[model samples]
Target: MYDSGKIIAGLIVFVLLVTFPFISNMGKASAKPKPSIDTPVINEMAVKKCVEPKEFMRAEHMQLLNNWRDSVVRNGDRIYVNTAGQSYNMSLQNTCMNCHSNKKKFCDECHNYMAVNPYCWSCHIQPKEQPNEQPKENML
Candidate 1:
């Protein structure tokens, strides 16, 4: 009778273990809505293809800085419209602040969300600014 009870208890434990995953609602709150598989699909040729413009760099990404300067100072606008034919307008102010502000709040939130490892703080300084002293004075 003791052996039978042991076998019944073992069977109950095995059943609970196998069904635990299905019964658990641990992930239900955060689960993303499933996309409809029956939705009509459009062919690739039917959709307009937009290629991101090649990022310009003169020396070590200097061109990006120049572009930023031109967009901010010369154009007097933060938006850089790439008439070179693209679907989206690249905004310097929006993109920069989106990642740099509050370090952990906005930037880290999305970085952690997408599992991307950023290397900006390692080599370059944040809030890029002009040198306070003149180059000639530094040489003296």
Candidate 2:
């Protein structure tokens, strides 16, 4: 015959274990009111597409870089110009490639090992390319 005390203790423990999660979550449910479809929201900022910095370089970002390069000021004056010839005031410190040198030092070493072809070389110059190369027809 099973002990009566033992059976009662087992039933109490089982009930407590089953009820623990519900008891813990009861406070959270009462704390916040759920938002419905009719709720009014105010958003002032315009939505903009986000792109990674490396991916941005791979895309048609060369134009932006060119603009920045042209707008560099030798003096203390802060003057900037856009592609459309509009003048503005902004200071561009350096170019992107100034930091990322090679695949091993900056890009390729890591990406090559990972077997990922970063499209950055498409728009930007590769690290290994020579500064000057004669045309094939001219060479011959």
* lDDT top scorer: 1
Tens digit per residue, CA lDDT, model 1, 87-128 = 333443345433333444333444455556555445334433
RMSD of each: 17.1, 21.6
Those runs of model 2 whose alpha carbons end farther than 4 Å from true positions after fitting are 1-94, 128-140
- Per-residue CA lDDT of candidate 2, range 9-127, in tens? 99999998999998787767443322221211112225321122435545655455455545553444445544546555542222233333322433443444445654444544444
Model 1 worst lDDT window (10 residues): 35-44
Cα lDDT of candidate 1 equals 0.45
Best by TM-score: 1
Error of 2 at 100 (Å): 2.5
Local distance difference test, each candidate: 0.45, 0.44
